[model samples]
Target: MADAVIVVALLLVAASATAAVAQREPARQALVLSVLGVVLAVLFTVLQAPDVGLSQLAVGSALTPLLIMLSVRKVRRQARAKDRAR
Candidate 1:
């Protein structure tokens, strides 16, 4: 059971990472990273490392997603401004 969970988690992470790498749009890539981080947090919890899982949840899942969203928003704004200037 544990092994299966681990394998599934690994696959999920790998797939997400691959998708992120393939994505050309910054916002889409960020979204993929955020999803991957949350999936990793869940995998940590499944491995019975509550402390590590919580830390991952807070830092990777929550904070990372927030930062990515902020960056994406800023980038979009800059792109719009540049377009207007042209």
Candidate 2:
């Protein structure tokens, strides 16, 4: 049973990772990346590493995605400003 849970968690992580990579837009990619992070956390927990899992959940699912979206927003805003200046 434990093995089966681990396998399923691994599969979810793989699938979410693929989905993240397959995304075209930066915002969409970030969202998918967040999902992938959560999936990875689940996999870590399944492997009996709760500490690692919690850190991954906080960093991957939340912090990373938040940072990515902020970066994207800043870049887009700069582009718009540049366009208006031109």
Query: Candidate 2's residue-wise lDDT over 1-86, tens digit each?
Result: 99899889988988998899999999999999999999999899889999999999999999999999999999999999999999
Q: In model 2, which residue pairs have backbone atoms overlapping below 3 Å?
A: none
Model 1, position 14, has a per-residue lDDT of 87
TM-scores, one per candidate = 0.80, 0.96
Tens digits of per-residue lDDT for model 1 on 1-86? 88998999889888887987998987777778778778888888888887898898788767887888898899889999999999
lDDT of 2: 0.95
Model 2 stretches astray by more than 4 angstroms:
none
Top-lDDT structure, candidate number: 2
Scored against the true structure, residue 32 in model 2 reaches a CA lDDT of: 96
